[model samples]
Target: MIAFLKKRAKMSFLLLLKVLRFYWLLLNVWHFSRTKISYEAVKWRNISIYFHFKSKIIKYLTSNILSKINISLNSSNKNFSSYIK
Candidate 1:
């Protein structure tokens, strides 16, 4: 009886860890998705002064396009899923 309880406790702990890991992964992906501009800036930070300015411009353009695309895709996905349901 005690051994069975111990096994159940260990299984639950493992399941809890799995759930936490899944949530951690999702949060990491969300954080990365929101860091596009910062990523570009950091990428060019140590390279050169000239490229740093270029990176800022590229980052701004990229983030803008990405946000617009994300919005459109979300709207489209919602519409498509609505049809399916």
Candidate 2:
């Protein structure tokens, strides 16, 4: 029983070490990046910047169309489930 407990204890210690190592790696990468921005976040940020710039061209046209259509600005998409994958 004592030997089995020692083996279990050693396994638990090794698992804890592995988890700490993984966390340390993530922290090291975050520190190196200095902004905590992951690859996907950077990609999305670039896309948002592009879209914002493009929106300026349509801003006037959309406003005129909206006024003519008389659509309420407060209305939202009630079928939220369609947005989920």
Candidate 3:
């Protein structure tokens, strides 16, 4: 299994990633059936977790970038004033 992927990876990295994703999804489906769990439950949990992680990262980055922009603007304003005088 790993050896097959390694061979495909040498041919194309994108194809290798697709193969891995499909393999994992097949594994999850097999587990879900054995456990008699609702697929919707797993799907919901996965979607929520992905969204929560993305939102947190975006919010943190936005705040950081905004702060940096504000600092740059304030410094430039001071320089402009010195030039005018």
The model with the greatest lDDT is 3
By the lDDT metric, which is better: model 2 or model 3? 3
Candidate 3 lDDT score at position 7: 85
Q: What lDDT does the true structure give each of the candidates?
A: 0.82, 0.75, 0.90
Tell me the lDDT of model 3 at 45: 69
The better candidate by lDDT, 1 or 3, is 3
List the candidates' TM-scores in order.
Answer: 0.43, 0.40, 0.60
Model 2 lDDT on a 0 to 1 scale: 0.75
RMSD of 3: 7.4
In model 3, what is the error at residue 40, expressed in angstroms?
A: 0.6
Report the C-alpha displacement of residue 1, candidate 3, in angstroms: 33
Clashes of each: 0, 0, 0
User: Compared with the true structure, what per-residue lDDT tens digits does model 2 show for residues 1-85?
Assistant: 9999999999999999999979966865675599866777766765887799889768978988888666443333434445653
- Candidate 3 lDDT (Cα, whole model)? 0.90
Instruction: Tell me which residue pairs clash in candidate 3.
Output: none
TM-score for candidate 2: 0.40
Candidate 1 per-residue lDDT, tens place, 1-85, comes to: 9999999999999999999979965865666678754655543543576587889999999999999999999999999999999
